[model samples]
Target: MSDTPDTPPDGFEFVVTGSGVELAVKRSGEGPAVLLIGGLGMPSVTWDISGLPGSLVDAGFEVITYNARGVSPSSAPDAPYSVADLADDAAALLDHFEVGPTIVIGYSMGCYTAQSLLRSRRELVQALVLFAGLQPSPISAMVGEMELGLIDRYGEVPREVLVFEQLLTTLHHPLLQDPATVTGWQQVLSAGYDSLWTAPEGFRGQLTASQQWITSGEPTPEHLAAIDVPTLVLAFEHDLFFPPDLCAATARQIAGAEFAQIDGVGHGGIFTGPGDSAARITEFCRARRGL
Candidate 1:
């Protein structure tokens, strides 16, 4: 069952089945493939909104973005899935496209999925870039617990409110200090809230997977040390969740991995703020490809 269309504009958009779920996948541009793995509960459109996808496309690399199973437009399988399950879904997309070893970029929870991909299907990866990525730690787990607890306690809080709260906490302090910027983000959140929150099962399934992954005790330092691909780890200086120090520690786990910190941004900067993250990613990939 081939999913490719006779004429796909720029690249392609189709559904691929993996791990007993259908994943919505889109590919664009014309150079080497670059797979983008988004954070937990993030839809593929977030990549477009963040300018990462368009930036990469302009930089001469084929960009691939997909809604992970349980994300909107993607099928939500039964519960009790792990980060490994998400990784498996990623691998299935790569195989479906016959993508060779390519650049893989993971953000936030997507970092966990990316690591799992490297461990399970190392041959599919040529290089790796981790943005605001972290290995699960006690502190991180506690934060996750607190966030989930709030959701459970509120019972029926507005999605926009939840998103706004997240933005306030994860966006750089400077961004928040600017009323216009903050308002812009609020508008974005308000516009997307319905699409994001309408699919309750999608959110629940991904949340369960995140909780399970955080508590799974996998991706230890030993597992991280096993990744042999050229890797770059980017940490945001003002990130509250994955502090720069811990992100650097994660970088150290990968042999020969390059680590850098994006100053004046928080955990959400890579996606929301005006930062050089996209340029850095383009440079890294170009250097690796000898472009």
Candidate 2:
């Protein structure tokens, strides 16, 4: 592990080599450990946009974030990888830090990796917070396939444009509907896309990994039912990608898991409108810790 001068305020960066991959990991803050796993095509730095990382830090949690394999600053192997592989990377990070137990937070595609970690490295995960998570379903699989096709045809730029458009048109969140907010978001997204994604091959690798996991036929209801850890499932009311009902259903499979919906927000709400997201997560983590 190494720390450089360029590390963000109060946070230090290090490289953890495990499972034939070198992951770029960042750690910050104090108190209970909170491990954040981001969604598809998102690097750890993307979390800065959501403000959730800072909020979590202020809430007295040591926030841990990382760039998964295939993302820049992390070694990308040529071979295809699985969700379990990603979980191994997370476990490796926790081991490197010698953190006893952490609250694992997963967003969108990260939920799969989180679940894998919970199943395989239960000792490392004290609780779970799944944001906009869903079990693999036919509709969701179809959507993934459609996205893969778009990536193949138009590449990442058009795909990013399509996703931005979808967030605006389908979510109907005020943050996205406001003209000024929309323009600001467009500028931010455009300016950061290349930096965050780094390489088209890396993005394609992530897409391939997601597709493989979705089709892997694991993490079924039976599998989820086996998870006894405390879990908080937060779904957005207007998330077209993972409908609230589906998210709720997934929560029900986990024994004694708490399910909630953030009203008037969509899949991108956690980043655009983080008020409810931050509040719900902080409350859940505190409650789990019996604070």
Q: Judging by TM-score against the true structure, name the best candidate.
A: 1
lDDT tens digits, residue span 202-241, model 1: 6656666777777876557788788888889888887776
Residues 188-290, model 2: lDDT tens digits: 6667666555356666667777888778765687888898788998887877667889778878888998998888777777665554777788878877663
Query: Which candidate should be chosen as best, given lDDT against the real structure?
Result: 1
Quality of model 1 by C-alpha lDDT? 0.76
Model 2 scores worst on lDDT over the 10 consecutive residues at 1-10
TM-score of each: 0.85, 0.84
Give the lowest summed-lDDT range of ten residues in model 1.
Answer: 1-10
